[model samples]
Target: MAENYYQTLGVDRHASAEEIKKSYRKLARKYHPDVSKEADAEEKMQAINVAYDTLNNPEKKAEYDQMLDNPQGFAGFGQGAQGQGGFDGAHFYRQSTGGGEHADFSGFEDLFGRFGAGFGGSGSRRQQQSFQGEDQHAKIEVDLDVAYTGTTQQITLQIPTYNAHGEPEIQRKTLQVKIPKGMKEGQQIRLSGQGQAGINGGKAGDLYIEIQYKEDKRLYVEGADVYTTIDVSPWEAALGGQVEVNTPAGRLQINLPANAKNGQQLRLKGKGIPNSKEAGNLYLIINIVLPTAQNDQQKQAYQQLAQAFNAYNPRA
Candidate 1:
């Protein structure tokens, strides 16, 4: 009998995407080969993965549902439909992509499940007309500095496939990617011919990778602009002078205006993300740091300073 994906994930056939993911994650925590002490954890994990791969994808899930609805509906559509080998539409779809040796899922990790805005793929799989393979999308996160300096990253994606013996399996495909400098958040990098294979010699679809910056306590990004906080001594805020500070690109000194107020902002032009077209600006937020007096001399100085501004009621 064909495996029931809904039963495999312990979900109702009508489970929503979130519900399915939640259930899959719950199972993953339990039967994940690395953590589970169950003797058959490996087999159970493979079965779990196979089930999730089908149910998580809307297109595959729909076809799988249809196959369940009508067991003999796809018999004439493909050679391995049901019965003979318990195959279904999804199985043929996997074959259409390409066959490969099963890869290890040692560190399988997928945060933003691969889906797309529907670029193009797997269309018109009729007998006469060829169809392009489906395009794939994945999101990756990098440090804020990568936008300034650029970097190379290797990513592994789980691809569903069938083995030579005609059993469903997941394949791990890793690729080295070059992240160009000045790339902004939500930007996409296209890898040609890296998606599923086309039917009847049609051109293969492309893989689009979206870029995301990891969160940083000191820095924040807004489009091409960058913002950061810099602490200034009380005197520096009151009596403007040049001070050196750090930045994503490097450190530099900036002149502060006399009587500069706390929480004031200074813009350093062309200091933000360096995209190929235009560079962004960097803004520094000033925070006044006060010094506490412990010695008599320091106390006397503070008293004198207070006397100089005796009539100045800050609140008033």
Candidate 2:
């Protein structure tokens, strides 16, 4: 099923032309193929474009409305009879059969040729002469913790303003963007009217911010869950007990089994990023490090313990 364009753009059904354009720009930047990591981002972008193409143009919007109002009524009269109350079958037939009402009118070929030359040419010319400002691009580095639990960032963008002939000038702008929850690396947040000033009086293009994640040494995030290594003493591995640990949320005490082996995974439920519908899990892998002999007393203590345990095997 075709998605609702207004819903995709997150606008109302009665949105004005400017509102439509603004919504489209915001969504386009969000889902643009080059920058988005969301699943089906391109499909979303295509739908947005289709909706903008249909709604931005008055003629297309009218035709689309006509079809919606009277689904089976108009066979080919792209212009429906809703607003044209006097229009009926006779008028349609007369117009189609070259009758008196349109006797002075030329055939479809000539009419279309003139229309093609006039409206199509002028539309293309107007598009060519459109006074769009240059698009601005920037990169923002957000922490992975922030990515996990969405955040708002105050970003400053420096974009080159352009003249009528597209010569570069200087401009700086700052925007407070609400980073959507669940936003991932390479995702974009578009700020409309935050780019270079428009040429003439046209609306400003946009500022696109590509997301980059800050590295976290303690925790490695993959989607919703987090992974980290926790160190334990040799004795702790032999006899498990509760240990203090640090997580993205905060420090907490968790159980570390006495028999915990190196590289063994211990899972903490609902301890990771919050954006996930279900709280993400935290995985801790055990890392055991041996204490080195530092003094004669320490070396003697280890030797006595080894003697009591009789556990030393150099090769083993």
Candidate 3:
């Protein structure tokens, strides 16, 4: 019996794409051949890869879901599979044809070729199943600037697929992918006919990639909004002043409000995640920095400021 990809990845059949990816990552790290001490680490890694390949693609997953939904296909007599003793065709073919030797079914072409090479008379495995290949999926991490400004990038992926003999193999592919501006995290960009190869003479499938942003030191994202920390001096927070701030969108001179407290967020509307409609906002979080009293003059200044605020209890 074929392995259930969901079980292989330790994910539920209805697991979301994100959940599937998370599980795959965990299992991959555990079974990584170089780091793992287990004897079956390499084999487990291979299975994880194959499972992720199937579950990551929407089309392929749907096909697999359909198969799983129909348990009769995996068990006894399904549709025309009925026999005197519920005999399986592939089993019978292998037995009667001398353990996979070619059998010429010239007149029974329609009968044998209906189920691909598993029951076909004599043809290359690829020539038997004339259907479009399963679509493939991959994820990419780019800098925040890449989301602001569109760019093209080269990407490589190990595409899992079946070859002419109906055996699984890895097809390494490198492609130049175009990234459009305003591409949000977890959004997908599609490339046509770049997935697994088509069976027989059928049309090939497409390749889709989920675009993500690499973590930035200062910037963080929530929904469409972007947030970044801005450092301001004690004076800048205490008194309204013009402060130069650097943001992912650009640099700007912001007017700091009087008595702006620490962790105060100043919103610059429509300045983040640019798009034609409903653009996101950029939020500047204020972080007040204290000046060091390094010398007598600075210490005296701090003393003076403390005296001026003697009536104010900061702890209060």
Candidate 4:
């Protein structure tokens, strides 16, 4: 008896057509003889292909279901459907025609053609069809400055390609990719037709480049917005004044609010990453820095200032 078709594909007997197709695609990628390194990969792939072919077709699936329901009646059916020998739909057709030598196989040709196209044929070679190349994914690191202002970057990738002998080989591909400004972390940049080469003259696949930022202690990125700490002298924080600060875009003089407290965040609109879309905002977090007295005059000034604010309790 043949292996249970559902069990062969690791699907339920009532698995939907879409579910069956998904399982087949996943298993095909895993156990394909050209890719798989397992000793029994070829045999396992043949079984997977046969299982998918039988269950994928409505008519064949119905026939298979009936056989499963009454195994005794179809005892002679699917004798070599398990391992090396694939499911024999042709033999089943022959048996249905009372084992006659003139049994017609033309009706089954189309059925087998679809299955044979997917998995390399067993008996006769079938006409090969064009297949789109698989898509590729990679990561590219850019500085915060590059993210703020769009720049072109040259990236090299080791792409999989098939040689004349149909053996898989890695080829180095260098691409000059333009990264748009305001591109956030985890954002993808697509390169058309730069992925794996197609099979039999089919269209090549796309390459997706995920953006990552290099570690910078001075800047923190959040989407299009950027944050940075601005160190302000204690006097600058206490008294309202204009101060010059360095930003990713450029240097700008910003007014410090009167009695500006530590950790206060000030937003500079349209001062973040510049892009065609809405520009990001830059946030400046305040950090008050106290100056240490280096001489008696400075110490006396600090003592007088401390005495002036003696009544104020920060912890309270």
Poorest 10 consecutive residues of model 3 by lDDT?
Answer: 78-87
Model 1 compared with the native: what TM-score?
0.53
Predict model 1's lDDT versus the native: 0.72
By TM-score, the better pick of 1 and 4 is 4
Q: After superposition, how far is residue 261 of candidate 2 from its true place, in Å?
A: 1.9
User: Which lDDT values do the candidates have, in the order given?
Assistant: 0.72, 0.64, 0.72, 0.75
RMSD of each: 14.1, 13.6, 11.2, 5.8
State, as a TM-score between 0 and 1, how close model 3 is to the true structure: 0.62
Which regions in candidate 4 have their CA more than 4 angstroms from the true location? 1-88, 91-108, 111-126, 158-172, 274-277, 295-297
- 189-212, model 4: which lDDT tens digit per residue? 999998877655668789999999
Return the candidate ranking by lDDT, descending: 4, 3, 1, 2
Q: Give lDDT: candidate 2, residue 25.
A: 56
Task: Name the candidate that leads on TM-score.
Answer: 4
Model 3 C-alpha lDDT versus the unseen true structure: 0.72
What lDDT tens digits, residue by residue, belong to model 2 across residues 1-316? 3334466678887889988886675565456544456787646655565556557767656655655567566555443232343223223333544457554323323333422332223453222112355568889888766755677788776676654433456767777888876665677888887776654366787888888777767557776677887888988888888888766656779888877888999988877666546767889978898899999998998889889779768588
1 against 2, candidate with superior lDDT: 1
- Give the Cα error of residue 32 in candidate 3, in Å: 32
Candidate 1 regions with alpha-carbon error over 4 angstroms: 1-132, 157-169, 196-204, 292-301
